[model samples]
Target: MAATLPIIDLQELQQSSSSSGKLREACEHWGCFRLINHGVPVSLMSEMKKVVGELFDLPIPVKRRNVDVLSGSGYIALSSMNPLYEAFGLYDIGSTAAVHEFCDQLGASPHHRETILKYAEATHGVAMTVAAKMAESSGVLASDGAGLFEDWACQFRINKYHFRPETVGSAGVQIHTDSGFLTVLQEDETVGGLEVMDPSDSGYIPVDPVPGTFLMNLGDLATVWSNGKLRNVKHRVECKEAAVRISIATFMLGPPRYTVVEPPAAFVDGGRPRLYRPISYEEFRVMRQITDKQAGEALELLQGPAQPLSTKFDVNSLPADVLAQIQDID
Candidate 1:
């Protein structure tokens, strides 16, 4: 039988304990899941898609004006390494000024600009909610989860895959893990090519396009923040057919500027020492760039020194029942 990705309903996550368990399972094992009824209006999603298509349809010169506010954070032009992939980016979607700048650069009409802003705001709200739920699911946040994501930087990307029949079955983008904490993605409703690595058998499992639903992926930062309890899934896109594929992704990066990235106190106890040393997002980002460790190997370089076997236990490695027993004891 073919493998399937987990589908998590946002509504159920609040009202059902089993749903919360599923969220935890998805984070630990798959590192990604399909999110339904996530509160983003379907009409807004459709409007955003139409606007993205129109933006990408703009002439290369106009699109090029969407220059990088940060390295590789603006317009990613077509390249030989990934000829089928191109993207426009906004370094900070939470800022109204930043959104306006992106629109002006792309010569977006007022209506397009409004749609973009609305979509960004809606998605950002959803991202923060999901982040809180994730923290709650893992016991990182209990009563006070509201401020967990405050002031966190969010980057937005609009990806376009120029697929052709001749390119079918070829990679549209290389396999890699996301660099942030959590990613909220609006995938192309009519095209399917996304595949995530199945950690169990190391095989690729297709993530088919589901209209009106968002797909969420944990990233390298999530793994570190959770003290290695969360999995940062590896994924890729391929040319499935001779049709343009578009996706909008909003990434909630770790803490505010100049803030350190490390597991919260909840993740580190005598049983679970800090898995990664504290490092700022800028430092980590530069390290990834300098070493070209985009697939998450750079994280291993930051692993805390080995502790004596009797001093610590790998809670993530324990089976579900065993973990539950430990939690019960606590």
Candidate 2:
């Protein structure tokens, strides 16, 4: 048996901003919270679930052939088995070619494209709202001198976990933090495997599936953006009773790395000025992904006359048209 996770109401918090203090504390302690009565429409949620189920139910061979690790698109089947369960992963949705191929393989209608885009946009709006509130609670600015998460990028993924009834074991994801700033998850009502590690209690707490609500959790980039003010991501999924679990996650990435991330003046003291080296989000992400850890070792390298990373995104590779389209995404 696992300890019960806490549930929070976003409306209550909005009505009384002071309640955000408690929410912030919960995030710091548990690294996760469930948000009830969030603004997303129920119908949209239903359509997303229906389409995802239809897509995943396609033949196994069709799904397997679509996997592309290098291109960062398509279905990935159980490549990473968490300590307690088996799961699939997907990422990078902007690849039009891959999306078309996937839809064709599933024999899904062309309307699925509209459905996916609508879902993504709605999720993005919700993510922005939550991020703004979170930034306000954590005392961080959204780069536009606003309290909300402006200039944020959103990515959505669906996870399906299968279990065998007689196995009598856990079957889900391992304990790990997300790579983005924030994660909003809508899980199936029947299955329950999501768990968050309580830092203080040294025990695992179960986050039961709740209908009409979304679960919010911080990620590694969020911790960095908040300059350690917010909680670090620490959650895992476990399968019990051999029941399958399906979850949809929306990852809200923080402002571009070029935006400076430093502690607010209110939190900084005379002796404790800014500590982190200023780098764009893109640079940080790329460097973090690189196998060579030493590639980003020179902190003072930026202060000197050396060329900045921003210069690397050359005009030839990323034309003005491309940059304009990327800007329009937010």
Candidate 3:
């Protein structure tokens, strides 16, 4: 049987200790979970979905007006690279000013802009809540009980799958792990085409949409931050039917673009060795793009080289005090 995607209740998470364990396990084993009762308003969600559909329906020239503050951050059209997928991205979901700029860039109407801003606010809430849960599971207390993950930048993407009868059974987007920390996704309620590769490397599991809930996927940065503990879920889309699919993904991309993305000191210890060299989000993203490593394997290139074990150690060869004295030989 295929593995089942974990379903976590946000309300239950706040009231029970078992949910905490499930959250940790989801991060370590599955790297993704369905989140329900997450507090994002249902009406706002509906409005956002309608607006997303409208945005994608715009003419190609109008859609292309969604430029980026950074290349690869803006309008992505259906092309050979991803023939069945087209999307628009926003650089900083945490910034109200940035949200306005994104609306202006796309000529979003008053209602659309209103819905987008409200959705952005809700997305930030969900991201912060999940980030806190992650740190709690790792025994890292936010200095002020919160705000550690608040400063992180989030990038929002609205994706459209142009599925056709002829494209059924064909891939819409190739398999890949998200490049950020965690992604909060609002999937199409009527379609089912998303599938996540099993962490055990056995097979893929279809992720069916659950109404009034959001989907969360821990990503490559999650693996780095967790010292290789998190699974860094890899997933892809296929055209299962001839219906169009629309989804909104808000990625908690970690600290600002230029800031170093590193594992916490707590993650480095006697048994859990640090896994990767420090690299900024932008740098790692650029490296992956330049190298054409959009798949899960890209992380291997960033891994810290293995250290040679000391094979000559013999406890009997050292005096009682020699272990402390041997540190300065080099």
Candidate 4:
């Protein structure tokens, strides 16, 4: 029998401990789940899909104007690495200025611009809510979880896969793990091409399309933050047929550049050792790029002898400009 992702009811998550437990279980085991009742209206979702399709149809010159705010955070045209894939990205979708800038760059009409902003807000809400739950499930206090994400930036990517008859059975996207904390994805409603690596046997499990649901997945930052307790799933998209596919993803990228990513005190204890060292998000991202370990293997390079739990950087000791940046972020 084929493996299927666990279905997590967002509504039940708040009302039942069992649902919460299942969520944690899914995080530890599957690192992914199909989320329902996530509060994003069905009508808005449909409209968002239409908007994404239109955005992709924009002329190449206009799409090229959507430049990168961060590395790979802007227009990603079809390349040999992902021949079937192209994308438009926003460094921080939560920023009104950034959203409007992207809209202007893409020449989005008034209606499409409104839809994009609405979709961004809705998906970002779900991302934050799910991230808080994940942190709580990992034993971090509610206050701490809120603090961890309150100021974090959520990057956005609207992807398009131009699958052709010759590309069927080939990979649309290479298998890899997400580098962020969590991802909230609105996948194509009719296409069935996403697949995740089954941790139990290291085989692939088809992630079929299921309308009215969002797919949530844990990522590399999650594993480090949970002290290796949470799994960072590896997944890919395949060319299932000669049809276009679209997926909108919101990535809860790790802490601000000035802050380092380390497990909370709850994750580090006498029984559970801290597996990774404190590293700023930018440093870690650079290391991953330098080493070309995009599939989560760079985490192993970060593994070191455990340090005293009290070992930490002092905020007051930071350079004035860095501190100013941190203040602005918060």
Give the TM-score of each candidate. Answer: 0.88, 0.72, 0.87, 0.90
Give candidate 4's error at residue 70 in angstroms: 1.6
Off by over 4 Å in 2: 1-4, 60-73, 79-107, 141-144, 165-171, 257-267, 271-276, 279-330
Runs in model 3 deviating more than 4 A are 80-82, 144-146, 305-330
- The local distance difference test score of each candidate is 0.80, 0.59, 0.77, 0.80
lDDT of 4 by residue, 271-305 (tens): 98878887766566555655668778979977877
Residue 110, candidate 1: C-alpha displacement in angstroms:
1.6
**Which pairs in model 3 have colliding backbones?**
none
Report model 1's TM-score to 2 decimal places: 0.88
What is the C-alpha lDDT profile of model 2 across 1-330, one tens digit per residue? Answer: 555555777777778888778777766666677887777888888888887786677688766655433212345565433223222233333334544554565556777766766676677777777776776676654553474355665555676776666544543554556656778888888887777777667677777777878888876566555555566556766667676667788777556435645445534557645445455545544444332222123232433455446724332244433322121000
Put down candidate 1 lDDT per residue, 1-330, tens digits, no spaces: 778899999988877767778899999999999999998999999999999999988999999899643543667678675478788888778888989999999999999999999999999988988898888888775544457687888888888888988999898866878878899999999998999999889899888889999999998889988889999988988777999888999988778654777677778899988878776665565556556676779788777673223212222353443322110000
Q: Ranking by lDDT, best first?
A: 1, 4, 3, 2
User: What is candidate 3's lDDT per residue for 210-295, written digit by digit as tens?
Assistant: 87889899878888777787888888887899998988889888776557666776677888777786766666655555466776
Question: Which residue pairs clash in candidate 2?
Answer: 84-170, 84-171, 85-171, 85-172, 132-148, 171-239, 257-280, 257-281, 258-280, 258-281
Cα TM-score of candidate 4: 0.90
Superior candidate under TM-score, 1 versus 3:
1
After superposing candidate 1, which stretches have Cα over 4 Å from the reference?
16-18, 142-146, 305-330
